[model samples]
Target: MLLHESQLAQGVFNLTWKVEMSGTIETGHVKWFNDEKGYGFISRDNGQDDVFVHFRSINSTANRKTLQEGQRVEFKVIKGPKGLQAEEVTAI
Candidate 1:
């Protein structure tokens, strides 16, 4: 055997972008929902992928009444665990 050594890069190759939004009331209908589990998907404009929203993160009371199948409300964009959860929801 022979002595051997090597050096590797010391910095991370991390890349990320920021979510900036002064949100306003927007209409989004519930695509898939489980009221009992307090988790569901909302289909936004342009027909993009539905974003997941959890009851634990909502400012309103943790109940299905605070949300509905086709509710229109205003909220800010947040980088949540499941990605892009609505915050500070208020009726239009």
Candidate 2:
């Protein structure tokens, strides 16, 4: 959710506008992933902002926990320290 300065200013004064997460399970495609870094962003199918996905969140049966680019995945959305993050991610 990209916010303009005007909207941020208005929120500061009026305290109305805000970003909210539904905390629901969602499906998306892996936009890009760095296997070495063990982190990536998923392009949500719902057209929302991309959610950050950590390797730890990946549900893998193998030893390596990594996601490939363009892979389809299902995950739960959570409000992370930086922004929206993916949790309990599983390949679909």
The most accurate candidate by lDDT is 2
**For candidate 1, lDDT tens digit of each residue in 1-92?**
54333322211211132243435545566555577887766776646556666665356654443467776555555555346765555545
Model 2 spans > 4 angstroms off: 1-20
Candidate lDDT values, in order? 0.55, 0.87
Assess the local accuracy of residue 45 in candidate 1 as a C-alpha lDDT between 0 and 100: 63
State each candidate's clash count: 0, 0
TM-score of each: 0.52, 0.75
Worst 10-residue lDDT window for candidate 2 reads: 13-22
Quantify how close model 2 is to the true structure by its C-alpha RMSD in Å.
9.5
RMSD of 1: 10.4
